[model samples]
Target: MNKNIVITGTSRGIGFELARLFADQGHQVIALSRNADPIRALDHPNLHPFATDLTNEQSLKEVTQQIKAQFEHIDILVHNAGALVNKPFEELTQADFQKVYQVNVFSVAQLTQLLLPAIPKGGHVVSISSMGGIQGSMKFPGLAAYSSSKGAIITLSELLAEEYKEQQIAFNVLALGAVQTEMLEEAFPGYQAPTTALQMAEYIYNFALTGQQYYNGKVLQVSSSTP
Candidate 1:
């Protein structure tokens, strides 16, 4: 079945690969990113690249408005855009925290809320979280802001699942382990992760296709012992 899928941060990394996979599978992909060149380079007819800064309220509003105008219902929404600020808790300022939250929390909340009208029953919402945000886990240094933002996403998804069950909308968060993406590399230099962006993208694409049928309000942790 051809589904309407919206993905964020499609300029590169896991989101980019996901867009490619979805388009290849014949689904309509609305790819949102600050830069649309990479998405446009895909040259997939099913891919519609929209350049919009997720952290900017006006930009998000315009994109969401355009989406609502064009699509009656969004079958899937993958919130893969995130910001990571690596600084010691004490070194991190209010502005730093706000910047991370703007992309990881506020913008996601805003976009999802605006797009809800276009998400009918059976719609699935998945946000990419991090293992750092997983509760009761080993804490990493210099990741307080990023981890907290992800934790908020997990909580938000759980709450949304319960609140919108009547509407049959499903919400989930994927707490990803270190994937060999720019974000991971930036956070952990000279470290080789056990997973690659393409691998993670494949995993997410499969889950987005049928996750609602079996899971909601679940935070699935994905990782391995070795690369």
Candidate 2:
């Protein structure tokens, strides 16, 4: 069956891979990113690309308008656009933390709320979190801002799942670990990541296909060991 899916952060990395995988599987993919020109150049039949900055409310409003104009309903909504700032607590400024939260937490919730009307009763809402969100205060250090933002996402996902349980709209979080995306490289330069973008994409796709109510309201961890 074909699913109408809208995904953010589709310019590259995990979001790009996820969009390609879903489109290849005969699903309608509305790809959202800051750079729409590149996504438009793909010219895939199952793919529709729109450009918008997730952190900017005005840009997000324009993106939402486009989605409303194109599709009557969306079966899947993936919140994958996030920012990470990895610096020691002393080096991190309040502005830096606020910026990260704006991208990773605030915009995510705002976009989801705006698009909730378009999500059907049985649709899915997937928030891409991080292992750091679950583990909390990692020994790796220098990730306070990024980790906190992800932690907030996890909490938000749980609350959303509970709030929308009666409506039957599933809300779940994927706590990914060390995926080899541009974001990961930026967060931990010179470090070898554990997972690949394609692998993470496959995991997300399979999870979405299950369509099981049991997965709803849960934070499913996806790593090298998870299958």
Candidate 3:
């Protein structure tokens, strides 16, 4: 069955690949991004690109309103947009933390709340986190803020799962390892990861499509030992 889907940060990287994945599979994709040109350039009939800054409450509200008015139900909601600031823990300022939280945590929670009504029973919500958020055996330096924000995403999903259990809305987080994306490059600076954004997108797409049938409120860590 063709399902209505909403994905954030679809202008590039994993989000862009996820949008393409769903559109190719014949699902209706409402792709959200700060810049919509790349999404529009895909030119997939099943893909609809909407540009909005998720950090702005009013802007997010307007986008949600448009979505609510246009679509009767949303089968999958992927909160893939995030912000990252890599700096020493002492070098991080309050403003930096706020900015990271605004995109990585606050916007996701707010958008999920607004779109809850549009998600019918058996709907799925998946948020992308990082393995930095996971309790990795090896700690990563200069990622305190980013890791903390990603960790919050997992907890939020867990609580939402319990809170909305009756509705059968499955909330899950993918605590991804290092994937080859611009975000990864920004954080690590030239270091390459074994996984690519397209590969991660494939895993995410499958999980979002059938995850509810198997799991809920789970934070699954995806990683590869290959350096």
Off by over 4 Å in 1: none
The regions of model 2 sitting more than 4 angstroms off are 136-139, 225-227
Checking candidate 1 for backbone clashes, the offending pairs are: none
lDDT of every predicted structure (CA atoms): 0.93, 0.86, 0.92
What's every prediction's RMSD, in angstroms?
1.2, 2.1, 1.2
Clashes of each: 0, 0, 0
Q: Where does the lowest 10-residue lDDT sum fall in candidate 2?
A: 218-227
Q: Could you estimate the TM-score for every candidate?
A: 0.98, 0.94, 0.97
Best-first order by lDDT: 1, 3, 2
lDDT tens digits by residue: candidate 2, 52-162 = 898899999888988988899999998888888888999999999999999889999999989999998898999998888885324357888988898899999889989
Q: Whole-model lDDT, candidate 2?
A: 0.86
lDDT of 3: 0.92
User: What's the ranking of the predictions by TM-score, best on top?
Assistant: 1, 3, 2
lDDT of 1 by residue, 1-227 (tens): 89999999999899999999999999999999999999998788999999999989999999999998888889999999989998889999999999999999999899999999899899999999988889987678899999999999999999999999999999999999889999988888888988889999999999999999999999999877421
